[model samples]
Target: MRNVAICGSHVKNFISSPSFVTAIEMDGVPIFCGLIHTEDIKFDRHIPENRFKVLVRKIAFSYNYRDKNLIFTTAIKAALNRFYVVGSEFVGEVIDIGSDVTDFQIGDKVIGNNHYPNSGIEGVPGGLPSNNSSTEYQVFHQIKLIKVPPQIPDEVAATISIGGQTTYSMLRKLSLTEGSNVLVTSANSNTSLFAINALNKHKVNIYATTTSMRFEKELKEMGVKRLIQIEPNSENWVADELAEEIVKEKGSFDCIIDPFFDIHIGKLIPLLASGGRYITCGFYDQYSSLIGKEFQYRGLTTSEIFVTMMLKNIQIIGNCIGKTEDLQNAIQDYASGSLNVVIDSVFSGKQVGEFFERTYNAKDRFGKVVYRYD
Candidate 1:
């Protein structure tokens, strides 16, 4: 099997091996580095009655922002003689099943169920099918996978599991009514793009925030009423003329869906109307390099944030990747033409470096960067 992995500062591919190791020297220190690669993962040919093994001959996978932290942490563990397979979203086909497995067949396409907290089945442990999806083979419980309908393409299916589940979960928490004024921060992110597409069906006045307007037309087509541009490294929402004007015209947002609370919460709290809701799924300062380099916004203090939320009755909610039904509903919406995944690019063959660069460092990336293992 062939797989792509993160190596120190480069992306590389290598064939499956019993023991694989790579390291890079920096400042005279040898640092072991690699995350997400194929391995000779062993599985019983006589599978457990409730489990199945997938011979993932082809896979389309993508990265989430959280992978940055995973990459850094996994490298540290790699030095300690620990091995980890890391990837969050992907789609694959099953080629083998347990004798008792009845719901899935050898040729069915599937995505991770990702049911959080509990796997729903009594004995099947689950959070994600595996925290690792980049590998070419995996064993999963029947409850840990969801069959994908034929209408959804591989690229879209690979990217949908995390973004779609989280988006639908956050929207459920917000529970905004029709015609409500809603703000979606980090609007170009995969989760936010999914939110925007899902929100288009809600008949709400959608306001999105981004550092660039490069995708302005596409966002508008996705039903964003206004796109507010902010300084890349600053949290000066009040100083942004377009943001201020929108706030003045709309009074205040009825709900806010933010991807990064550490960056947006202080700047956006004052914009939440009384009894409004503020929900966030994740944050950006996940890796060590970004430590102590938090965004700076003027005038908003911790005391003021508390006061604003208290006085306005704002509901601040935190969410993780959602239930199995959320992923199912998202796929159903996609099949019905009510929702779509926006893919920035797809890579294959030896474009490993370019794929990782576009996924992690592209300033103009507007959607998911996918890798198709051919």
Candidate 2:
């Protein structure tokens, strides 16, 4: 099976033999990907009597920021000899099923469940279904996959799991009331897009921040009440005209949803209302290459942050992926036409480099970048 993988400097120590190697470059860095032959798994011989497992053939996949960090860091890991297959969100077909599997059929369409915090099953660790989803074939427990409804297109299904799950999970934590003033940072992000769409149903007053107004119309259409455009080079949010505008109009935010806490925490915490809630799922400076590079806090110290939170009775919440029900609810919303996934673009065949560039480096990208296998 041909899979997209990160072949480190010592790849030969990991992959004993690959059928062929294909080199692709992104941001001037070489990514080694290739086709490899593997012995077919005999389901009958491998299936456990008590556990249900399914063999899936990947159809399409998408990148998350986490996946991007994983790829780049794995490429440069000093002692990492294994070639890591890079992808998290994917849509696939169930090619085979174990005898105990009753929830899926041989031809069912599925996406990873990615239940987190708890998998609800004994001894089953909850998280992504596979870190190596770029592989053409993979085996997963039946509980780790969700059936995709016929109404949701393949591209949307491919990218929906992480963003949808995380958004629903974070919003559930916030538990905002109707008409609550909410701020969403990194507004062009997939999670923010999903949050905006879901927040529309909650009837909240949504204010979003972006570095550019390139997708202002689209964001408004998604029900963002106000779009605050900030200068890319601006360091001081206290003096930023756009930031002041939000403060003038909203007074203070009742809740703040941020994708990167490290980038926005110092700038945003001062804007939260007394007793407000701040929720974050991730940070931008994840990999060593980019760590400490985003200095947006303007010298805001940890002591200051704690002081503000303590005086205001503000709550800071950290969220992981989500419960299985979060994904289920997102899927239900999509099926009922109440929610949608925003896809920036799709790539197929051998457009590997283009996929990575569009996924990671495209300033104009406002949604998920997908790669489909033929």
Candidate 3:
């Protein structure tokens, strides 16, 4: 079975989790001569205060488990058990079927989600191995599969399971209203572009931000109401010289969606009108804590849209996505052509590591970079 595992060796360099190590300690020793005791202790290379942050990390993982059907690991020693079958979302010629299978047969084209094969839960896995579809012949229960729609392409459909789901979850959290105003940072990103197109049907006004003017024509074609050209040194918290011009025309966004976390969260608050929403799913950089007093003084609220913290009445929400449903919604939108899927370039799968590095660094390019497997 040739399944792709995000091997721990590669994961350590990119992962945020500190390595888990073994150590011994003495607790409340009352003159016990020659007594040695051992207990597991945490040593986070990322921070000095590991325990306090551990609670936050655990809470975040628990939230992801509920929302996205997978876990995000920060532990260097934790095994890389998270994965999905490559062909699950695309229609494939079934090579085999279990004796108990009822809904499917060999040579049938199918589309479905990847799940923990044994436990039968959507994202929760029983103590079973995850590699399934990567094999020459793989088998799964009929109940776990969904029929693939004939209309979508395999490359576009491939991302629906992850990208679409995530975009939907974030949008839902934003609770956009009819005629709402939106500011999408990194407007050329796969999710960002989808979001703009998602709200295009509504009477909402969209202000798309990009680092280059090259996207102006493309974004305009996608029906973006406005485009804000951002320089490499653009600051979100401090008012730019162009801030007045933007606010004057668009009246500031009712909700702000950022995917790359390129826009500083602290700086993003001021870009919103009073009681406007600010939501994001990915933060590529470490963030400074939100200044509540600054928000209070400005009569604005702040939030991080994880599943755990529910923000009501404030209008701003932070959302993270990891689920099959979210993926499906995104996929459906794309298939219908309402959402535009723009790829900057597609590289061979072997170059995926460098692809991500380029994505993370944003060296020189525009649009989403997809890695295709032959």
Which candidate's lDDT is highest?
Answer: 2
Instruction: Give all candidates' CA lDDT scores.
Output: 0.77, 0.82, 0.47
> Which ranges in model 2 have alpha carbons more than 4 Å from their true place?
8-28, 34-41, 78-82, 231-233, 238-241, 290-299
Instruction: Give the winner by TM-score.
Output: 2
TM-scores of the models, in the order given: 0.86, 0.90, 0.58
**Of the pair 1 and 3, which is ahead by TM-score?**
1
Task: Give the alpha carbon lDDT tens digit for every residue of 1-374 in model 1.
Answer: 54455444222234234323455432233334343444455655475553444444447888888876676665544434344556788899886776667778889999888888788778777677766677667777777888999999999998999899888988888887999999999889888999999998889999999887899999998899988887755555435676667757889889999998878888888889999999999886676453334444454688998899999999989998888888888999999999978999998765655676688668888899998877
* Candidate 2 lDDT (Cα, 0 to 1): 0.82
Tens-digit lDDT string for candidate 2 (1-374): 66766666555444545444456665566666554455655556144753488889899999888886777777666344556778899999999888778899989999999899667777777999888888888888888999999999999999999988999999899998999999999899888999998888789999998888899999998899988876545566434666666677779999999998887887789888999999999987766463324344353589999999999999999999998889999999989998977899999776766787788878888899998987
RMSD of each: 4.0, 3.1, 14.5
lDDT of 3 by residue, 1-374 (tens): 22222233233333332221111111111110010112323334245322111110000000011111111121122353322222122234455444445656555545445422233545444322222222223344454444446676554443444355566777777767888888888776667876777777666888887776777887887878888776545334334667787767777568888875444454555556666777777754331221111111121234442221243333545555544555566566766776665555654434434443343345454555544434
Clashes of each: 0, 0, 8
Residue 355, model 2: lDDT of 81
> Which consecutive 10 residues in model 2 have the weakest lDDT in total?
290-299
